[model samples]
Target: MTGPETDNESPETDDEPPEHRRYARYLELLESVQEADEAGLVAAVLRDDCVAMAESAVNRHLERRAAQLLTDAHFPDWARTTAAVIGDRAFLSRRLREWTLLRAIALDEPWTAEEVTGASDWFQRTAAAAQAVSSPEALDLLAEHGRTRRVRNAATLRLRPPRRRPG
Candidate 1:
């Protein structure tokens, strides 16, 4: 049974390209599917024409968006790795500036962070090895911040601080 055709009720098939770019290709492919004379194709179930194509594209876009959201929700692994590699102080500073996760982190950030941490670990291990080779001498430089000390030089032999009990 058919009546005067309307826009919404246009033949389950129409030559107009789908309204969007992504599904335009799918629509074209489906049109070819419709044209096939093989009974198998005709019977292959089109998902009810336009509705199927639109729904498929929406589902695809939603799936991709969900994956991106999930990755963002659990991005701390990269931050911790970054903290470990860049060294605690620099990592803290950079984190204060902006988290790598806050930026577009798809291609380069993760790889660069791994490399940084690897190099940092290597440097630490190397330093420990070198320190094991010989004991290094260190000097202690201390000053009494509140107390003033009289200078004892070749030109002046007098001292000003009391060496005995203050009581």
Candidate 2:
């Protein structure tokens, strides 16, 4: 018997929105996540195959998906909590690691060691301005382990604590 995979079929002919037609598959997956229960949503996001596909997706699709995931407060928070429990290999953790570097490429933010590995030459500059400030601990982390020499030096300069007045 011929299975659906083996059967010849034309592409989807439904009256989908024009913008979505270009990335219908990704939009469909994201729609399903919206419809899912809390547990189902987590399972879908955590799937290794889904994570891999997201990692390789073209920039437009990746940015759309990431922005949606981040904007919908519950999902990103849940992903973070889940990652804390399950470990860094969680899908969102890995995606955000890439997202950070992709974002940094545009605005001159320093790259973290874990964020810059295996990046390609093609990248979009995502930010208009550098972050106004970073926490001391965060600057310390970057000063110690930022991926480039420039990043390390810049972070070290920003790592100074606030001055105290005379007693």
Candidate 3:
């Protein structure tokens, strides 16, 4: 007995495809992240899935903000890279192939600000962890991590070596 569907009808109904439903959920989560205070932001990012979704979401502003939040929280380089790779899909795809190189040098788990500071080679450790991932989404995550690591390392190499201390 329902009349024609109106433009204002909620998109959350069973009529929507699974992808649309997931996207709607992502949008909701993005709003929650945007509304969160610093502590809440930290908590949200602690969930690996949340951070992973934040990286690949279509909203550039959300992606960049998520990256900034991770950086502010002192997350490892891979985490930072995850958020940094939002704009270029082809670039992200290519980076996935080189993920194995990161195996020895990255951190494989989500960390708090306190935990991240003590880790060495977070990129390599994260990459190593990523080796087990088989899905395209997981590959995207690994690719972002590798890309960030390479950029950070390159930047470091570009810096002049420290001058020798005066005798």
TM-score per model over all chains: 0.19, 0.34, 0.24
Off by over 4 Å in 1: 1-22, 25-49, 74-167
Q: Rank the candidates by lDDT, best first.
A: 2, 3, 1
lDDT of candidate 2 over 29-48, digit per residue (tens):
54454433533433433343
> Candidate 3: lDDT over CA atoms?
0.37
Stretches of candidate 3 exceeding 4 Å from the true structure: 1-12, 34-167
Tens digits of per-residue lDDT, candidate 3, 1-167, equal 11112112365566864444444554555556533243333333333344344334434333344334432434444344543443244433333312322221232333232222223344334432432322333334333433456533433333335579899
Q: Count the backbone clashes (under 3 Å) in each candidate.
A: 0, 1, 11
Residue range 1-167, candidate 1, lDDT tens digits: 11112133245546554333325443344345321232232222223355454445433432333234323644455344324433434433343223332222322233233322233322222212322212111000001110122211210221123368778
TM-score of 3: 0.24
Please report, in order, the local distance difference test score of every candidate based on alpha carbons: 0.30, 0.43, 0.37
User: Which candidate leads in lDDT?
Assistant: 2
- Candidate 3 clash total? 11
Give the better candidate number (1 or 2) by lDDT.
2
**RMSD versus native structure for model 3:** 14.5
Residue 61 deviation, candidate 1, in Å?
Answer: 0.2
